[model samples]
Target: MSLNRRQFTKLMVGGMASSLLPSSVLAQGTTKNNIKAIAFDGFPIFDPRPIFGLSNTLFPQQGKQLAQLWFSKIFGYTWLRTAGNHYKNFYAVIEDALIFSAESLKINLSPNDKRMLMEAWLNLKVWPDVKAALLQFKKNNIRLAFLSNFTEEMLRRNAKNSGIDDMFEFYLSTDKVQAYKPSPLAYQMGVDAFGLPKENIAFTAFAGWDAIGAKWFGYPTVWVNRLGKPIEKMGIAPDSTGKNLNQLVDFVLT
Candidate 1:
């Protein structure tokens, strides 16, 4: 019997709970491409809330405003730099964004405040389910790597802090290509690192735009929609969408 998408998702989740899913459920609705490696966007693996919370604590009244502006500027600076052929590393872009954000918000950011906020990225904690899902991927011998706009130092520090440093095979940074996501060169890093067809590397994205970027780059893509945001109006959609890493595992493994 054929199952609709919602029914199929229910069955898959139930099977996961019981530690056994029907083969039909596993095979149904999954991508035809044989995914050999999984490349993850940074946000899906590292929780950024603590950094934002710290911003709030430091600024009190302006914390949320500062966080919002800083976050927006992070991507804005990267894209503008990439488009203008002006390349700085992701860490530099982030620091620039923070300064811009503080200035825009008219918040006097102290040197100590800047140091504390920047250090937060290095000290990020992984999402609660990340360890178990990563363990399963390792057990299955699936190659895993971080395909992110974060600098390699940022990725390494957080992974080591979270005790998952050994989980990944590649620490791909857009700095290598001197570009940012949705940039074809940035996405190509995953294909180059895995030495596999784009179809065989599943790109797991934490944001809708990243999912669209990976899809545009020809990988089978999964969007881990932790924020429950609506799909973008982009012409393409992801191969799958899930609420968290466990659901991402279901899409890739099952």
Candidate 2:
């Protein structure tokens, strides 16, 4: 293919720029980075798929729909409570969402079923890619913490279940500020706990909206798009995005 003079100059400049970065940095983008600490949203670290699997096991007919609605309602309540100043803890919000989902689907959820479903959240394991990435982060001296909307009790219980509780240096639950994410106060927990600038503290978000929230608060954010979802049309984007923790490790440690 032939190139116009302007196109040729652009290609030449791009080539020169690409040469200056490490291979991983080239993929993450051209921006120079200073990410010293990473603040992770809980779902990215703990595999929540098992909870959905249990829903399927309990209600074979309505399980898929129930799980989707319940998942959506969980975040819906968080945003609603934040806006209305109702301020329910995440665990309560989750239980409320589950009940609403079951009732809406006309599924008669037994007390034992409900108990088992909620308990699943407390016994989650990390995703397959999580341990290697976490070990690398620890090796690199990159400080780590949880910046989740989950209550500290929830986060701690899940971490303990995964056998990785000691991996986190802090748990910056939004419970402390009584605010869910997208609020500046909620994101500020990372900066305060890490005692680092928002730019230096990278936030790993499990959902697109949460990634936008962290970016809006000035954190260089990475959206771990584990479900292969598209980015939200929020007029903002994460600095990097990946399907799992391994890609996140490259973006940060590169």
* Residues 1-254, model 2: lDDT tens digits: 99999999999999898898776455335424767789999999999999989999999988989999999999999999999999998988999999998998899999999999999887888888887888888876778999999889989998888688999999889999999998999999999999999988889999999999999999999999999999999898999999998778777777
Predict model 2's lDDT versus the native: 0.89
After superposition on all C-alphas, the RMSD of every candidate to the true structure, in Å, is 8.4, 7.7
In order of listing, the candidates' clash counts read 0, 0
Q: State the displacement of the C-alpha of residue 161, model 2, in Å, after optimal TM-score superposition.
A: 1.6
Off by over 4 Å in 2: 1-32
> Cα deviation of 104 in candidate 2 (Å)?
1.1
Q: Residue-wise lDDT of candidate 1 within 43-119, one digit each (tens)? A: 99999999889999999999999998999899988889989999899888889999999999999999999999999
The RMSD (Cα, Å) of candidate 1 is: 8.4
* CA shift of 216, model 1, Å: 0.4
